[model samples]
Target: MTGTIHNRETFLSQIASSLGRSRLSSGVTDPEWKHRPQDQVLQDATPDELVDILKTQCLKIHTSLVITDAKKLPETLHEVVANYGGGPIVTWKDERFSKWGLEPLMKKEWPSQKLEVYEWDHTKGAENIRQAEKANVGITISEMTLAESGTVVLFSDKDKGRTVSFLPATYIALVPKSTIVPRITQAARKLRELHHSGKQVASCVNFITGPSNSADIELNLVVGVHGPVKATYIVIDDL
Candidate 1:
């Protein structure tokens, strides 16, 4: 234990000495020394520009992006489901979805036998993933989106579990265009502020960029090993 402590102290001392030497050699002080971050361009980007960048990045990351007006979202979503051969769908229970008139549309469009819509239940715990895994598709509303990395951030809980994005064969995400930021820093800051404010933030905050892919075994490409093989991002402009 003593030796480990001494080694750790030596490592820290070496780091401090190197930093001091570098600072002394560079005669100028960086603005970061005062703890101020660089100017955030993403936060200043217009919503429309951010959305455009997000769409482009999504394609590069192998994630499909569907843009539809708020009024046409239901039909658009239905089309996507039909293309996937409408089956079981696991979705996060967001109150906004019902208000957007999706619930009625779903009930009318999807018959009980033809389509099963499962709302993630908090009481199920780890079993939530099991339910989602059985579904053909999973859907969730993204709280924030990073255009830089083509990532959609989901805050999950009993009402909305990360399983909706991680377990299904196809993951569909509703990303409000307004939520699209230029990068991840702003998304992280928003999350931190929410947590600092004592809001009921989710235990699992997920950043999903695209469909799961790995070139692991003998360099053979594999998809959907860890998560959904297909990820669809629906950018709802009106929202």
Candidate 2:
């Protein structure tokens, strides 16, 4: 079920032959660009400075941002869930929840509060999507956060359903301070490095900025046309 390209070598060979050039798969280095402005953008910003940039960008993207330490994360999450109208919640089956001290809230607090919670189950298949569609809130941890664009990078694997972010009424992203990168340039470089190191990257990588926004209808900006109407990012300061 993996998205591995079986005919990649043959396909590239055919293209190379058509172009009258040998397949240059080995000993080929990346070209150097003199005017690489993308690398320069926010390049010198510290993590704290990046957070500040992200905060400002969030304001532009219509997303709420909250800063809290690991110790306060559970409480902060609870408050956010309450504000978004306690769920029918859907979340990724990620271990970071326990690592960041949210196991209690996930196992006890939410259930005791009579909130219906569903974690993404790969085995359940369509059932997960059904739950996500009915969910009032969907929660996920950001693999990476882009400061300049206020974007959250989601590398979707089996346990992380894309529908969890797309179908819910509200979305909450848990962003670790360490994941706060200056921009997409750094994120792209990280992905490239992973590929070069022969690591298995996720089949789907989603770069989400705030909620679903579109200006297709009458050229007027519309929010939540195809996804969550409200989005919040909880930035963990000491995770």
Residue 78's lDDT within candidate 2 is 90
TM agreement with the true structure for every prediction = 0.78, 0.89
Compose the digit string of candidate 1's lDDT tens values, residues 32-100: 455435345566777887888888888777788999877888778888877776768888778878766
> Which stretches of model 1 miss by more than 4 angstroms?
1-44, 105-108, 111-113, 124-127, 217-221
User: Mind giving the per-residue lDDT tens digits that candidate 2 earns over 1-239?
Assistant: 65777998999999999999999967878798889999889889999999999999999999999999998898899999999989989999999999988886567465347778888889998999999999999999899899999999999999999898989999999999999999999999999999999998998999999999999879999988999999999999963
Q: lDDT for every model?
A: 0.80, 0.92
- Evaluated at residue 6, the lDDT of candidate 2 is 90
lDDT of 2 at 94: 91
Candidate 2 local lDDT, residue 176: 92
Error of 1 at 162 (Å): 1.8
